[model samples]
Target chain A: MEVVIGTIAGILTSVSMIPQLIKVLKEKEVENLSWMMIAVLLTGVSLWVVYGIMREEWPIIISNAFSVMVNITLLIAYFLYKEK
Target chain B: MEVVIGTIAGILTSVSMIPQLIKVLKEKEVENLSWMMIAVLLTGVSLWVVYGIMREEWPIIISNAFSVMVNITLLIAYFLYKEK
Candidate 1:
């Protein structure tokens, strides 16, 4: 039961950026999306990956690595869509 | 070392939404902020809170609960600030 809940929780949080990423792609509007939020999230998840690697925790590494990738993609889109 | 890394990672991720929240509060522009993203995150962290309760982990409970509050506030602000 805990595993079930934890897995769902992990997956949801890990991919929470996807919706925003899609919105950005379709709408090309990022006026309200905070770059600091994305950057902090990127840093946090990157550190989680490091922590997981250090602890040899595959679950943490995989989940957070995916988050890192998504956030990086979001960061790129933020740059592209941001008004000059 | 792992604990320190994990603690920092946890702190950063747990409070990651704060910058976005502040942006929304100040700008009153939520056009680019996806409700789906915030809703998914709110669900994820709320589950984490439940999992923490089951496992009797105070840190998890406290951190995730804080996230839940932040996400809820963000959700409310999203509704208020979102363009009609």
Candidate 2:
């Protein structure tokens, strides 16, 4: 039950940015988005990954790893869109 | 060391939304923002709070608790500003 709850939480956090990502991509505008927020979120997710590794928690590790990827993609998109 | 890392991560995640929140409130616009993303993020953060409670992880609890508040504020601001 705990694992189930954790997994649901993990999944939620992991994919929380998808809609935003899609919107940003389609609109090609990121003027409203904050680079600092993205950078800080990346840092937080990275630390969570490390913490998960230390605790040998696979769910945390997996979810945060995916979150890191998503954040990186968003960052790149923000830069690219900003450049246009 | 682990605790320190966790705390840092918590801080980063907890306050990550401030800049965006400020932007949204100041601009009084949320047209670029995705309501679906915000809703999903709220769900995710809420679940994280629950997970933290179950695990007795105060850092997670505290950080996510703050995140929940921030997200809720953003949502409200998004609607209010959106209406304008």
Candidate 3:
């Protein structure tokens, strides 16, 4: 039950950026977005990954790994669009 | 060392939304913001608070508590400014 709750929470958090990512992709604009936020979030998520590894928590590791990927993608998109 | 890393991560993640919050407050606009993302994030953060409680992790609890407050404030701001 706890695992189930954690998994759901992980999925929700991991995908929370999808809408923003899609909007940025569609509009090719990031003027309203904050790169610092993304950077800090990426850093935090990375630490979560490390924490998970230390605790041997697979769910945390997996979810935050996915989150890290997502954040990196968003950061790339931000830079790419900002250059335009 | 691990605790230090986690604390810094917590601080970064907790305050990640500051820039966006400031931007929205200054502009009084949320046209580009995604409420769905905020909703999902709030849910996830709430779950993290639960998870932290279960694990007796004070950093997780405190940081996510702060995050929950920030997210809630952002949601309220979104609605208030969104109407303008």
Candidate 4:
């Protein structure tokens, strides 16, 4: 049950960003996205990574680690497209 | 250290949604949002909440439960605005 629930949580959080991710990619307009927000968010994601590590929770760790990657990609895309 | 990390994780994850939530509420345009997505998301969040309960993880539990509330609200908003 625990594993099942954790898996569900992992999937939920993982897929939650699909819409925004799609929008960002499709529109290629990330100028409205704030740098401060992303910075703060990265910091937060890092902490979650830590939490996952400490707890030995593979689901939490993996999901958050991938999240960091996505967020970084989005941040870079924002910068690259901001002047476009 | 664990507490500190958990707190940071909680805050990071909590604030991460602000931008998206703002966009959805301010624009009142949720037609682009998908019901299947929200349903999947809720199911996932429910699992995370259960994970938090099993682990006695206040940070995870509180954050996800609050997430559920926000998601539900967003879903309702989508439906409401869709009909408008």
lDDT (C-alpha, whole model) for all candidates? 0.93, 0.87, 0.84, 0.72
The lDDT ranking, best first, is 1, 2, 3, 4
lDDT of 3 by residue, A1-83 (tens): 66676677678888988887888778888876778888989998899889888888888788889889888998999999889
Best by TM-score: 1
Q: What is the C-alpha lDDT profile of model 1 across B1-84, one tens digit per residue?
A: 998999899999999999999999998889888999999999999999989998999989999999999999999999988755
lDDT (tens digit, per residue) of candidate 4 on B1-84: 887887878777766656655666787776434566567767777788889999998878888898788768767876877788
Tell me, per candidate, how large a share of the native contacts it keeps.
0.83, 0.73, 0.64, 0.54
User: Which regions of candidate 1 are displaced past 4 Å?
Assistant: none
Show model 4 residue runs off by greater than 4 Å: A30-40, A53-59, A79-84, B30-40, B53-59, B82-84
The model with the greatest DockQ is 1
What tens-digit string does per-residue lDDT give for candidate 1 at A1-84?
A: 988998899999998999999999899888889999999989999999999999999999999999998999999989987855
The residue-by-residue lDDT of candidate 2 on A1-84, one tens digit each, is: 777887887798789888999999899898878788889899999999999999898877888899899999999999998898
All-Cα superposition RMSD per candidate: 1.0, 1.5, 2.0, 3.5
Q: Give TM-scores of chain A for all candidates.
A: 0.95, 0.91, 0.90, 0.75
TM-score of 2: 0.92
How well is each residue in A1-84 modelled by candidate 4, as lDDT tens digits? 887777767877776656555666777776434556566777787788889999897867888888788778767766777778
Q: Model 1 chain B: which ten-residue window has the lowest total lDDT?
A: B75-84
lDDT for each residue of candidate 2 in B1-84, tens digit (9 for 90 to 100):
888987788788778888889888888878778888888989988998999999998877888889899999999998888787
- TM-score between model 1 and native: 0.97
**Chain A alone, model 4, TM-score?**
0.75
